[model samples]
Target: MTQENFNEGLLGFLDASPTPFHATQNMAGMFENAGFIKLYEEQRWELEPGKKYYLTRNDSSIIAFTYSGEKNYVMVGAHTDSPNLKVKPNPVIKEHGAVKFGVEPYGGLLLNTWFDRDFSLAGRVSYLDSNNIIKDALIDVKKPIAIIPSLAIHLDDKANQERSINAQSDILPILSTSDDFHFEQFLKDQLKISGVDEVKELYANDLNFYDVQNASFVGLNDDFIASARIDNLISCYVGILSICSIDESKPMLFIANDHEEVGSSSTSGAGGSFLENTLHRVFDDYEEFVQMIRSSIMISADNAHAIHPNYPSKHDANHAPHINKGSVIKINASQRYASNSKTVSRFMNIASSIGEPFQTFVTRSDMGCGSTIGPITATRLGIETLDIGVPTFAMHSIRELCGSKDAYSLYKIILSFNDS
Candidate 1:
């Protein structure tokens, strides 16, 4: 595809995926488009070389790998998960004339951005059937279903820049005014669970409120891209595309894991056995693991903190990464980013070969550093690794910003790495 076409596809993917499930599903579709053969761990185990393969876990994480008898494995990693408010079980409740729902903050959410915005519901729901078999299902109530309206500016005089959000009281979204009791039934109705199943565990599941608005390229010159979940979804998309584009001579893997927002502790997260299990399953022997380790390399893809325009003092003056300047090499003195001199040089070589511009970022000496899956994955597998990402603003905010050119640049660099 042409460069313009590639960017358009990337923007479309970003707009469509607001949650981890959506991100995983979108990437899975792209793999199918690229002619990747789907593989299921439970179905069968067959050995083959020079074939494209993809797999998913808990409908939240995905791993796609390709091989062509090359000794070392080159892997790109990204997380599908993002921070948002999760709907509680038996969420809908009636109080006075208004209907509100209990919401648990899933991760570090910018609670205020959620105010006065149209939001929708999208996630999986599980239920039990006649034979007592558990059935898990996907649901998308695609319309503007709920909203957290802001109290009038008159009520809160300092509303513009100085406002405090109470996560419990201030953020309970308005479901309906007169339809209180029905609101509870509305959730049950959406899940298609019977009202009789009071003893049964009925929930909206991992239901999170998402901005109903679509992601878009904005700015007078159309340089800025705005979207929710851009922090990691952008990397996830690039990783998938890069792996699929290359005719691998080496074992190449793209692992888009879940639950990176809350420290990557879940079973499918970077801290868990998802990658370990897949690696073991692929190598199938102790000797192969040794061989794989000797030559393997990893590129951990996530969003990096770009120098914010409004808050220039927040970032280190000498180490700030700018938009459209190419991928940022993130390092931490605490070993949070897993970058070493040798691995950093290897990535530099890859960047040079592709003629892609690259830069480096380290937190100011006194500031605490943020961690990524790069360090964890590298430590667990003993793989040489480097941390890289598209420079972005609002790293964990509900909606984030990045330069369109930078995203395309990151994709090109990752494509080059995967091709290598």
Candidate 2:
């Protein structure tokens, strides 16, 4: 596909998704549109050589695998969750005649970046109905939903670059006027549940503040994409596309896990039983299961840190990745990433066979680096894996930057591996 089509698809995913549930739903829709079948973990299965199967857990993680007896297994992994704010159970509070909701940071977030930005709330809400049965549902304000306005510029003139944001007090977003101080009642009404007193549980909620602005292609030549969740969503999207585009002559899988940022510890997280359970279900016996996992190679697809124009000194001088150059293979000597020699060579060979341009990323010797789902997944499943990503900047910020030409190239490389 051309860049235009890719951008349209990317932006559409970013816009429709505000929470993990929404992200998975959007992906499931895309898979369905491609005519892939959906499967639940508890469902009984019959072997169908070339049939496609997709599954999800708690709407937080998803895996789409295509099975056909083959020489080897090829898979790609990415995370669906991103860093944002979560509303607390006692989110309702009134101070100085103004009403605000209390929020806590969900993952590693750049607190200052959230200030003065228009935001929204979107996530799963569980409550009891009239029959007293617990029912879960998704709620989205679907507009410029929430805002964390900054203190007046004059109040802290150095705010542009100097002020520190207190996550508890500084980040509480305004909901309404003084008359709106009845936040508990408002929340109960908004969620369509009983009053705080009648309810067995009252959670202000774990809500994130989204940009509410849809992603778009913007550049003098339209060679740029500005959006949220590019850190892993890009990988998730491309992985699914690559798996769907290729013939399932081999066992091809796309595993998108959750909680990568806070460390994948949940049951469906990369650090948990999702991959293991799925693998066991795929094989008939123990020995074959071990063999299958050994023969498989997972390409951990997440965004790599790109060189910043303004701060060129932060990166390793000898190894810097640029936008549109192709995929960046990240190697950490500390084993924080799973890129060993064998896995690295295999990835390079795949990229070379397809003539896809690729690069290497090594953190500067003195600077600390971040981790991805690669090491955690490799360790948990006892499979060889490599770390790779499209180079990007402003990685954990409210908005992120990436190369326009990179997605298509990465897609090509992933397709080559699956086809091979």
Candidate 3:
């Protein structure tokens, strides 16, 4: 596909996937449309060679694989969740006649970017229906309905120089100022609008506030993509595009797990047994499984921080990645990432084969580096892993930026590996 089409597809995926549940559902929908069958863990899996199948766990994490006879697997992994403010269970907090929702940060976030922006709720909500059966419904306000207004410059003289954001007091998103701002009733009304049937009462929810702005091409020549959650969603989309284009059915897989932001600790997270348990089920003989895993390779696809022009000193002089340069291979001696010399060379071969450019990233020795599912999955499953990403700017912000060309380049890089 053309670079323009690649970016458009990426935008469409980002728009549909504000929360992990939604991301998994949207991916499952794509798989179904591509003529792949769905498998449920509770049911018997009649997996066969040359058939494509996808499955999910916790409604937030998903794994899709083509079950061909190839014993050695090729895997691409990415996280579905992003950094955002999550609505608490008992989320209401009213003050000064203004109604607000209590929210907690889900992961490391650039809180300053969240201020003075339009926000809306998007997640799955559970409630009982007329049949008294529990039903889970996905909801997105789909508009700029809520906001966390920043304190005006007049109120804080040093605002431009320095600021401290209080998670408890400063981050509650203001919903409305009406005296009749009832949270439960408002949710009930939204359910009706969402075509949810027999809404008895709003029972429980796992909602998060996200920017209402749609992703778009930015920069002087429209070379950049400006949008929310571009950090890892770019990789998730690239993995999807790459795996689906593989013409031969093989022991290759794609997994988008949730809760990677805080840590991949949950049932659906990479630290959990999702990948291992799936492999166990797919293979019957223990000896074969271990041998196959030894031969397998995992490409951990997460967004890497590009060298910011204004903060060039923060990056290692020799290892800073450039925007639009190509797919970035992240390396750290401390194992925050999983890329080793062997796996790095494996990735380099694909880039060379496709004539795609690439760069490397290593943080300054004094600074700590962030991580991806690479190490965790590699340790858990005893498989070799490589950490790779499309370079990004303003990562963990409410809106981030990346080269539009870089996304498609990463896609072709992964495609080269699959085709090889």
Candidate 3 on 296-372: residue-level lDDT in tens?
89999999989999999989989999998998999999999999999999889889987999999999999999999
Which candidate number maximizes TM-score?
A: 3
lDDT of model 3 at position 287: 87
Give a tens-digit lDDT track for model 1, residues 57-159.
9889999988565657878999998888888876776886788878878778778788888888878777665666676666667788779889999998998
Candidate 2 local lDDT, 1-420, one digit each (tens): 776787688888888888888888888888897777888888886758888888889887898888786527888999998888878876777777677888888788788778777887777767665668676666677767567777898888887887887787888887666554564455565566322234445443545667777777767877678887887788888987888787756678898998898999998789889988887887868988888889989999999988888999999977899987888999999988899999889778988997889999999989898899999988888888999999998888888888888888889888877655
Regions of candidate 3 where Cα sits further than 4 Å from its true position: none
Q: lDDT of each prediction vs. the true structure?
A: 0.81, 0.81, 0.89
Stretches of candidate 2 above 4 Å error? 158-161, 181-206
Better of 2 and 3 by lDDT: 3
Q: Taking the candidates one at a time, how many backbone clashes does each contain? A: 0, 5, 0
Summing lDDT over every window of 10 consecutive residues in candidate 3, give the lowest-scoring window: 242-251
RMSD of 3: 1.1
| Lowest-sum lDDT 10-residue window in model 1 | 194-203
**Candidate 3, lDDT over the whole model:** 0.89
